[model samples]
Target chain A: MILQYLKLLKDKRIVLASSSPRRKEILEKLGWNLMIIPSEFEENLQWESFSHPGDYVVATARGKANEVTKRLEKCGEKPYLVIASDTCVSLETQVFGKPKDRHDAQRMLSLLSGKTHDVISGVSAMLSYDDGWHEIVFYEKTKVHFGRLAPEEISSYIDTGEPMDKAGGYGIQALGGTLIEGIEGDYYNVMGFPLHKFCSTMAPYFGRLVK
Target chain B: MILQYLKLLKDKRIVLASSSPRRKEILEKLGWNLMIIPSEFEENLQWESFSHPGDYVVATARGKANEVTKRLEKCGEKPYLVIASDTCVSLETQVFGKPKDRHDAQRMLSLLSGKTHDVISGVSAMLSYDDGWHEIVFYEKTKVHFGRLAPEEISSYIDTGEPMDKAGGYGIQALGGTLIEGIEGDYYNVMGFPLHKFCSTMAPYFGRLVK
Candidate 1:
């Protein structure tokens, strides 16, 4: 199905501006051999400043894309497109990034033990043009329902070290899967990238670029 | 989190009565060294005989489990438990198994495109008791909403040869992820196993067996 679209963009140089293995793996499903350049952007955005969690992640994703775009320009390497994304977990109004430490992970998991939370991922696609870059920003949200966790379960999960680098102190694709009762959206979004939305958004962009 | 439960079942023999790599991968997430013994049972159940799609799959799973359990007993090996599962795609009252060929896959995808269909997986766990075997059977349902797939896209997806071996003519965890708009239950259920439900069902049984 996507083979034709993949063939169209085969000659183009695509760059992913992040070091997340999950995100890279998600994008590679489109059959693009991506060039990875982890962005040096400082992701210290204030979550409270934005009214919506999606806006906060979009701002952070934009920061990563912009930083990587500038770096590529500095090196005189103009890639056809640059992709970046930021994922976060939110419980109502409060947003969570990666856990700072073990205690932080435990606190997040404890709070989310028997609740349903939203996993939001913001993506930025920076397309280079004749003069400058045209950036498209979007976000996808998935609701993840956690099974009631015992204190020992939380402690034991934290000990495995999977929660340290994931939002909401859990990775849905790993041992953390046992903790999730169900989900209500794109499963890939919870893994840090929204594969369906990303593919839909890029189809037209790639169509225009190829022409 | 599951390490303790896994430790309890360490010395016991566990069998998965299916040849599906996807199902095996889903179960291995619980840290079990499963023994594979694909059942010789013929899947010739009449979907019309069952009241619901879940019942139809549960019956099929029961057959597989019973056959594998008998085989193990004949070999003089009383395994701790035998896990078997059957998955199918249902739209309304109609059930779909694996497509017979590319055309059949295309037909299934066309009917499912832009519509929400149910992916139901029935699991049967046969536990050896002193006198005989106690059977535990349950089914999990997940609603999968697929994007409107173009004819070309459907043909291309079938070309990948992923749909022939999978129920619903698609594999949600692979190239088929692009075709899905969203899902509304345990993602693992769509992959032919329900991890959360399976874990919950086995916890109490494991407790009794270990004691």
Candidate 2:
């Protein structure tokens, strides 16, 4: 369905700004040859600054993209398309990011057990194409529900150490899949890329920014 | 993660008793060489017979497996394994299967709009090994929420002809994904297989399913 963008992405420089292996894997699945340049921007932004959780994620993503774009600009590189994303888990109104430690992971898991939560991923694609710097920001939210989990089950899952490095203390793409009872949005969004939205939004810039 | 079943399945005949292209695609991704033999058993059984929706799906899946197994046995080619599954969409207490036509599709979509629904996939695996016939049945349910969909959007999606064939009038693996707001459970189950559970259940027969 997105084949129209393939021709445009054939010869452009693309950079991904994130250390997330999940995002990297997804982009690679689309057959994109890009350089991974982790953004140095701190992700400790105050959630209260934004009125909504989505805005917070968008701001974080924009920060990452701008950081990378500025870095590449200083390197004398003509211009590259930089893609950055941030995902968070929200239950009711409480937002959850990467857990600070095992205790935090356990807390997050406990809160999510038997309750439905939202997984929101904000994506920003910035480039120096079209004779100017342009950026597109979009967000996808997926609802995920955790099955009723026993305390021991939660403890043992934490011991597996999979939840420590993932947002909301769970990695939906791996062992976390078992804990999930269902999801309402894009699966890849929980994994950190809304491919459908990404492809749709980048279609216009395919040849110029991606190739 | 499931690499242990390879040796045991090397010389065994596996049959997939389903007509779902998505299931075929997923099984291929799992690296299993399976023979497709779509079941001919009628699915006209009353849903009320089962106390729970999950049981209904399990019974349907078992029926399919039994139909296929009986045929294969009479043909003098007993498959080492016969896998069958049936998926349904349940919102509140109402269960939805494939829409009978466009009108039915629209009704199903309308009912699902702005609401969370449960996707129940009942899986049955039957083995006709040297000892005898052994079977296991289970159900995986995923809760999916749909964003409020516009009438035009629903009409356009239906025109694409994707919903007509999928239970619940939506295919989570395709264009229908765009309509989802979130989900909680196994993504593969909504797409018609509980892959993790399948692997776990098949482990014993295959010596060890996951590596």
Report iRMS values in order. Answer: 2.1, 6.9
lDDT of 1 at A19: 98
lDDT of 1 by residue, B168-190 (tens): 89998888999998999999999
Per TM-score, the best of the predicted structures is: 1
Clashes by residue pair, model 1 = A1-B156, A1-B157
lDDT of 2 by residue, B3-88 (tens): 33444475677899998898887666545789999999899977777789999999999999999999988888787789999999
Q: Residue A39's C-alpha lDDT in candidate 2?
A: 99
Score candidate 2 by lDDT.
0.80
Q: Which CAPRI quality tier does the interface of model 1 achieve?
A: medium
Deviating ranges (above 4 Å) for candidate 1:
A1-3, B1-3
